[model samples]
Structure formats: C-alpha cells, structure tokens
Target chain A: MSAFSTGAVTLAPHRVAAMVLRYLYLLRSSWTRLLELIYWPAVQLLVWGFLQFYIAQNSGFFARASGVFIAAVLMWDVLFRGQLGFSISFLEEMWSRNLTNLMISPLRPIEFVCALMIMSLIRLAIGMVPVTFLAIAFFGFNVYGLGLALAAFFVNLILTSWAVGIVVSGVLLRNGMGAESLAWTLMFVLMPLACVYYPVSVLPDWLQVVAWALPPTYVFEGMRALIMEHVVRVDLMVEAFVLNALYFSAGVVAFLQLLKSARRVGSLLQTGE
Target chain B: MSQAAEPAIAVDQLVKVYKTTRAVDGISFALEPGSITGLLGGNGAGKTTTIAMIMGLVTPTAGTVKVLGAEMPRLRYHVLHKMNFESPYVDMPHRLTVRQNLKVFGRLYAVEDLDGRIAALAREFDLSEFLDRPTGKLSAGQKTRVALAKALINSPRVLLLDEPTASLDPDTADWVRAHLERFRKERGATVLLASHNMAEVERLCERVIIMKRGRIEDDDTPRRLLIRYGRETLEEVFLDVARGRGEAREAAQ
Candidate 1:
C-alpha cells in the first residue's frame, strides 16, 4: 500500500534520460524494421545512383559529386531511416498492443517522445556508414573532410525524423494500421522534394524556398556546404537547427494534445476506440 | 467493517460514457486492503470500462477515481510505480525474450534484488525452460505466465488482473491461483480481478460485484448471493446477470 501511492512515480529527468537510452533497444530488437530503414535508400543508391554516375562521366560529375556522397546522399539516408526508426518502433508497439504497457507505466508522454527521439538518433547513427558505403561503392567518389559537419547533420536528421515520428505515432494510436502507411509515405513525399540526389541550387528558386521550409533540405544544404565550400556557413547550420527544433516541438505539442484527446475519447482502452 | 480502515481503492460515483451510451453509469465502490474484489459482467457491460477509468487508462465523462486515496493522473505516477497489471488481451514486445521482457518491466518498477525477483518468478511459474525464448513464440499458457511474472515484478500492493487464466490449462490455472494466493498472503495486497470464470470467482473473490447495462446489479459474497438468489453456484449467478436476469432476480428480492 505504501508503494502504490508513490506519486504514481512520474518519470524524473534521469528516468526520461534512461528511457531515451532504453528506447534504442527497439532498433536492435527488430532487424526487419531496421532493414526497412536501409532498404529504400539502398535501392535509390544502387539504381538511380549508378545512373547519376553514367550522366556524370563526361560532365565532370565525379569532381562535382566527389563530396556529394557524404554531404547530400548520406544525410538523406539519415532522414528516411530516422523516420523509419520512429515509425517502425511505434508501429511495432501498436501491432503488438504493447502501447498500453508503455502508456500505463510511469513513463510520461514527453518521456515516450524523447525515447522515440533516442531511437531515431541511434538509427541515423548506424545508417551513416551503410549509406556512405553504398553510394561510395556505386559512384566511386571521395566524400571525406566532412566528418565535423557529419555529426551535426546526423543530429539534425535524427531530430527532424523523430519529430515526424511523433505526429505519425499519434495518428497510428488512433487509427491502428490505417495510419502506418504514412510512415512510409512521409519519407516518400519528402525524398524528391528535399533534393537529396541534386542540389537545391539545381532546383528552381521557388522550389528551393519550399525545400528551405523543410528541415531535411537544410540538413542536405548544410552537408553540401561543408563538402563543396569547405566553409562553415553559420546561418545555414542555424537554419537547420531551428527548423529541426520547430518540427520536434510541433511533434511534442501534437503528441501531447492528441494523447490527451485520445484519453478523453478513451481510445487507450481499445486501440481501435 | 468500519469505514475508518485505510481503503486500498475508492471510486466515488465513477461514471464513463461512450458517445450517448453510459459505459459505466455512476458506480461507486471501495475495496479494503487485502480484499479480492471480483467484477463480473458480460461483454459490453462496462466492466473493463470501469476498470480502465480506475487504472487512469480511461477518462470518465464525469466522476472521480482515487486509487490508494490519491486523485488519479495527478498522483497517478506515484501510485502506479507500486502497481502492476496483467491482461490476456495485452502483450509485450514480440522481439524481446521472456528474460528481456521481465528485466525491462522489473527495471521500470525499479525493483531491488532484480535478479532474485525474476529468478524467483521464473522458478515459481516454471518459466526457466523457455525464459530465453522470444515472448511472441510462447504458447498462450506460457505467455500468460510471462505476463503474470511481469505484473508481479514490483510485488505490487494492488494487482489488476483481467482474465488471469483465459487460455490456460487446468494445471497451469491452478498453479496461477496458488501463486496469486501466495503473493496475497505474503504482501497483504488488494486484488481487483475481472474474470468470466465462475469457479474462479467462487474460489477467489470474497465479494463479487455484478454489473449490468453500465451499473451494478448486485454485490455480495458468492455463496450468499447463490443462496439468496436461489442459485447453486456462481456460474448460475453469472448466467443470470449476463443474460439480463440479475436485475429481475434482485427486484424479486
């Protein structure tokens, strides 16, 4: 009886931190989900990447694309895979009905979001090598001297994807399998628009404006700047960081509100409800 | 029984409505420490709904739920860390092994002597053989055992079990009952069980609250309710309630 009354035990900051650490366990446990994160980008690197090589043969694309592998392509992998990390982990919980276990536990809504962010980060971290390896193998280019920006770009990709995941998770919690499709579809919509395969400069100026509004666009933009210009553009990094923060914040607000709305509607009682 | 005794769970006019339907209509009941209260109702009678509100898993259209006398969700975390739940309908992550699942839950509850706690349950529940197996691979009985083990990780003061033995064999079912009894004796914990097994109700619960159409139709000890209602067993009592007969039987009295 003494134990039952211990503040239902809200997740303290350390516990929240620990949940973020523990949340990455989901990435290790599900290889199928992990592979899904790698699969799409791997396909793009293999198929379209070689075509880019065929076109770049005489166009000095090799020298132009030398740093492109690390700068542009790898970061895009991080975004797609980061979304995968968040979407798959959540979908796993919903499919298995383990969301109730999480919801009922002392873990708060913020803690849950933070945990998803942690998982997204881990996925993005692991994806860097494979994405680089695949594109390097396909395109035969040098993408070094960008390690410092790599870390920053990775963080931005992870933060952005996790923010996307929170919104996706809220919908999935309400509609079950119906909302899971968005997990894949969101990456699909963002992929071409982010101009990952090409530069934003390659796109028309107005479309680049739309790309600028997206965090991944900034991620690639910063990565491309590091590789092509070899100069730290403070403004671009700040823009990426701000956009990622905004998305992450929006996700947290939406998740918290939808979760409360869901509880008021009693959907937690029945996943379908 | 005096009302002064510390109540383990107190629900004050707890009401829940789903759309226009009153899922649980103005129900109030208090469970004393160490008592096992059985909630009995047919499908859609709001048994789960009422329990959900109490667990802070559902919001009442109107009403208050206090567990261990703390207004829920506000004090929800403080109390919930000391609480545990098991339901046949819920599942753990399929990719995790039984050992991993238990370890995760045990850590969540922050149970001291973690290894000892898990080892004890594994032995008591005969889970040592497949403790390394993924939770998804376990049979229904094994999964329930794992779920039960997960629920008891904290040695909770309050246990909420929904269909504790839904798919278990008689032997496993008896083992679960014995384990629960041992837990209750050692901890003096309160258990609120929602089950359809009448024999389980007769054998376990000292007080049975029968619900119908989102309200309690009757509340009594199983044997007393049996004799008073001209029934021979709890199964018959349940048949009456679930078939919409308990209300009439209560009126006749």
Candidate 2:
C-alpha cells in the first residue's frame, strides 16, 4: 500500500507544474500581467493607509491602536488577492479558449485545481509581498509582528479563499462566460459576514451566527485580539482551521461534481465561447 | 483485455442529447490504426459534438466511446497522453509567445526533451522566425500553424483535428495537409480529421464518415463516396450529403 501510494503521489506534480507553467509563461511574456499584479494591491494599500492615518488622527478609539485599520486592510487583501488569483487564472484559460485543450490533455480536473491553487500562491506572493513591505515603509506598521501566528492566519484565510474560489470556478465552468463577474464579486459578498475590520460582537445576534459560520471571521477576530489585546488565542485559530477544513473539502467536492455535470452537458467545450 | 489489433478508435452506439436537441444519435464506427479518416458534415451536423465525445470533452448521453481500447471519459487519462486534438474554434493562451505556448502544452503532455520537441515542430511548421511573437499578434495562418504545432507536441498516436486548415489560402492549406500526411506516415498516427474542405479530405483521408443531423449518413472511401453519388468530386458528394440526398443515394445503391 505504501509503495503504491508513493508511486501515485510522484506522478502528479509534473502535470500540475505544467499547468502552473502555462500561467507563469503568460506572466513572464506579458509586462502588463506583472504590472497588474503589483499595481492594484499597492494602490489599495496606499489609499487605505491614508484612510487609517486620517482615522488615527481624528478618533480617540482608533488613536490607541494606530495600526488596526492598516492591518485589517492588508489582511483583507490577503484573502481577496488569494481568491482572485485562483479564480482569475482559471478565467484566463477560459478567455483564451484553452480550457478544452487543457481538459483534453492528460491533466485531470483535480490536477487542474491543484495547479490553480499553486498559481494562486504565486500570484498572491507577487501581489502581496511588495504591498506588505510598503505597509511597513509607508505606514510604519509591520504586520509580521504577529509572528508565527501571522503564518497561521494567512493559511486559514488563503484556504478559505480557495474554498470560495473553487466554487466560483465550478460555477463558471457550468454556466460559461456569463458568470465571469463572480470571480471578482463573490468575495465581497462575504465581506460583511467576515467581520474583517471589527469584532463579531459588533454584528446583530442573527448576523453574528452567520459571521461565526465563516472561517475568516475567526481569523480576523483573532487578528484583532492579537493586535489590540496582545493575547494569543489558540482556540480561535483551531476553530478557523477546522472550519476551513470543512469548507475546503466541500468546495473541492462541489467543484469536481460541477465539472462532471459540465462535461455531461457539453458545457466544458462551450466555456470559452 | 485489449488486443494489439483493436482499432485505434471505436465508437459504438454513441449518443449525445442536449436539453431539446439530440446532437449525436446512436453513431458507431471504428478507425483502423495508422489510417487517416475524415469526419465530414456541415454546421450543426454533429461533427463537432461527435469529436468532442471522442476526446472525452463531452460525455455521451448513451453508448460507448473507446479510444485506444479504453472506455472514455472513464479511462480517459489512461490514453489521453497518447492523443491530441486541434480545432480552429479553440485557441492557446494568446498573450503567451508561440514558444511559450508550445512549451506549456509540451509540459502538460509531459513530452520528454520538450525543448527538442518544440525546436523540431517550430522548424517543421516554419514557426522559428515568429516563435517569440505573442500568439494573438500572429496572422491567422501563423496562429493555425502554432495551434497545429501545439497539437503535435506530445507526438500523439491518435490525432483529432477540426477544420485544421480553415481560413487559410490554398497554398498554406495544401502545405498544412502535406504536413499532416507526413506526420501520419512518420509516426504511424491514426487521424480523425473533420474538415469542410472536401478536397483536403480527398487528398488525406483513406476513408470518410459523413454525418447529418447527428447520424452517419454515409461511410466509405472518398472515391467510393464519389462513385456512389455519381459525382466528379467529393465536394459535390458533400453537397449531396448536406442536402440529405446522400441517404437516398445510399438506399438506391
């Protein structure tokens, strides 16, 4: 069993890398792609950083925790960019009418998803790393102070975003280009429930229940605790990880199932059209 | 167990029904190994749908499609690497250069010594000069060559081509046809070509399967189809098939 499992594991990466390289080649060949990756996130940081500064100067509640808004915006972008990176890479295949070519290749749908996840990581890194440095240099607020907990929060948020991204990709596969807008707008639909800049307690009773259901709420609430109270909450981190595990599993299952239906309906070939 | 003599492609009672339309209905045929066969039909005649089913891109509503003796959409991955497809309707990523697009597909197909393979295809297709140009920037004929090169990257034994030389001038189209013939001869590849150009089909295919309204209206060699229709060319015979006269001619024969 061990030998068989190991052999199976060894065969998947090259295929996945091939899919990632498809996008990497695009990113390398197009200066515009590279520019777009870094441009918008930096602009978001600069704009939101000014807002945070203005709030810090004007509000006594914000004055005590000067970096909270900046940290929230940066973390929120981590989730946004992670999700957008994944979905948009899939969209690129559709836009180029290349999905049929990829689908017909030896690459399986699951492997395609794996490649999308890896591409998302690469894109998120390209998009977020420079902005993270800019936050420190421009706002004098370093998000890395969250230490090892920062990595935990980032993983949970990214995984949750991936869960959303997979579902959106599945929808696009089944519905065609008419559903392309979901790649950009789906994450925002969950923003209010995520409690990115505030505590869950700030929401109404019913709304708080909905907020608790989403894994990112715990990450942001934990971020708030760590940044404002200087308390390390392992319970919140554990809860976020568990919820993400459930959401990620469901997302993958849904995506794969939808892909099967798309194939049956001949929607996979029509995706690019 | 599959024997070596099993046909390269076998479709038995294949059917694909979309909501209100039966795109491909109960079609059955088999292509011998190393043979070049043509799938001919006018628009909406189910040629694309049948090819899509053969590639495992579209699942059949009923019946079976077995490529390289493996039942498809189920055992697709087992044989997919051994096959490749080309269609003017689909494209590679346009922003990437021709070389970049080829390299990516070569890797996806896990073609060994990919750089060598890309170099060979570029030379064979005369793509070296524009290899670094973005695919979208290339002229239509150049893009068609790149698409064909991408399809051949895996050295696929089974090739499915749709309108391979569509929208090209006669010289380029004839050049593309000659290259396909050479690829078949050199690789012993089994080709299922769908083309509207009856002349290209007559020149390249050993046998022809003409479809109409999701059914195989006629299946024979190009010469046999011409004789059966009492026509001078495959184009006239194709017109007879498209206008639903081929069925009557076949019944009369």
Candidate topping DockQ: 2
Give one digit per residue, the lDDT tens place, for model 1 in A1-273.
012224433335544554554455555677875686667667766665666566667678555755465345556667777787777666767777887777777666765666666666666656556766765675665454465676677677778778888898887765566676898887778877787766788888788888888877777766666666776666777788898888888987887778777777788867732
lDDT of 1 by residue, B1-253 (tens): 4655868888888788778888899988989999998999888888888877777888778778888877765568758877788998999888778987777777666778889999999998889999988899989989999999998888888899888998889988988888888888889999999988888888889999998888998888988899877889998888877786767866777
DockQ of each: 0.49, 0.68
lDDT of each: 0.77, 0.90
Q: Where is the poorest 10-residue window by lDDT in model 2 chain A?
A: A1-10
lDDT digits (tens) for residues B1-253 of candidate 2: 3687799999999999999899999999999999999999989989999999999988999999999988988889889999999988899888888988888788778788988999999999999999998899999899899999999999899999999999998999989999999999999999999999988999999999999899998899988888878999999998987887867866777
Model 2 accuracy (lDDT, Cα): 0.90
- Give model 2's docking category: medium
Off by over 4 Å in 1: A1-40, A60-70, A134-144, A198-209, A225-231, B1-4, B249-253
